[model samples]
Target: MGSKLGYVYRVLKLGGSLITNKNVPFSFNEELVTNVVNVIKNFKVILVHGGGSFGHYEASLSKENTQTRTVIAMQELNLKILKIFNKENIPVFPLPGRYFTINQVLEILQNNLIPIIYGDILPNGNIISGDDITLTIAKHFHTEALFATDVEGIIINNTAVSLLKSLDDFREIRTSQFDVTGGIREKLRKIFQYKVNSLIFDGRNPTNIYYALSGKRIGTFVEAE
Candidate 1:
């Protein structure tokens, strides 16, 4: 935490937990989103979000095609996020699955526009989870990747775990517990394939987000070994 403001660009992936309260009803958590935006308003950031209880849970319960329903649900949820960002004058570009790709992420970074993308089933009939998007972005653009998630960090023994300082500690945990259609462990797995630095912090805590982007130790850091 040197100056709390020297990073060139930041990529923030907002977890579903922060935006929605449990499930049902599409509404924004005003305080949480506002706090998060306030923390990083000074820096150029690309925001990505998880489906959370919005599109993912609804699709899972419905009898509709997984891909089709997921796409529609994600589009709706993305709009919700867009509305919130717009109100704050954050200048968000909502890029759905159709527009998601490594090159697209790079282009957004180059243009200095904060992109607010979400995890959704890609148009190719494949699921592109939020964690997948985070890893993809981190791999392409060597910037700090922040995961504002429901859980504080990788949990072990009912406690927050820090694999960034001890990568070997996470080896024994089952991958299933960490998978959220695409989750922290998945992000860590894909991140290990690249040289990018990543972090998993409690999305409920907006201050942690500020610290993470500022290069301070706020959450669990995941790195490639």
Candidate 2:
């Protein structure tokens, strides 16, 4: 489904917290992920995921020599996701962040398959956040992003902001202690930096995931102006 402009790909990110229990090390929310995958099987979306309890817990253990461990942990979680997709008969393939060039992803899409990439540790020990990967592909194709997170959306004053246009709107939002990749704040920063319109919705509610993918904004819409 490419055009003279580009492929009409829906760049979606499955937040680590949405699929894994962030508080428990290496805890994968299999049932929730299975429901999410069921909804995703209907669409050919470019999928990106966070480290969550997997790589994040390992990365928090040591600053040095954790690259291999982090990658392995993230892959372990990714493999679990792959298994779900496979069981549902969805065509998906994994592309490590290190090898996640635009062309490599497009090649998978060209074959009518979905490409799944995750937040990974770069060779230099830098953490490549999943939001970074999502923005990279979404910005390239000028596509809107769908972020299925644990929260309903960006909340302020106990209410979710329907439309967010500036960073000042949620400056007080706190980042997680276990999140090595700067958490939600970092995700918002990249969204604004790339100027990619995105919907940050709660994946806890299975209906929200379906609504988001169906183009119905069920969460906070970030429009970097």
Q: Each candidate: how many clashes?
A: 0, 0
Candidate 2 lDDT over 54-139, as tens digits, reads 98898888566798899899899999999999999998999888788999888888888889999888878888888888988888
- The digit string of per-residue lDDT tens for model 1 on 70-170 reads 77777887887677667888776777755688667656555656777788775566666777777666555567678887677877666776766444556
For each candidate in the order shown, give its overall lDDT on alpha carbons: 0.68, 0.85
Reference-based TM-score of each model? 0.80, 0.94
Overall local distance difference test of candidate 1: 0.68
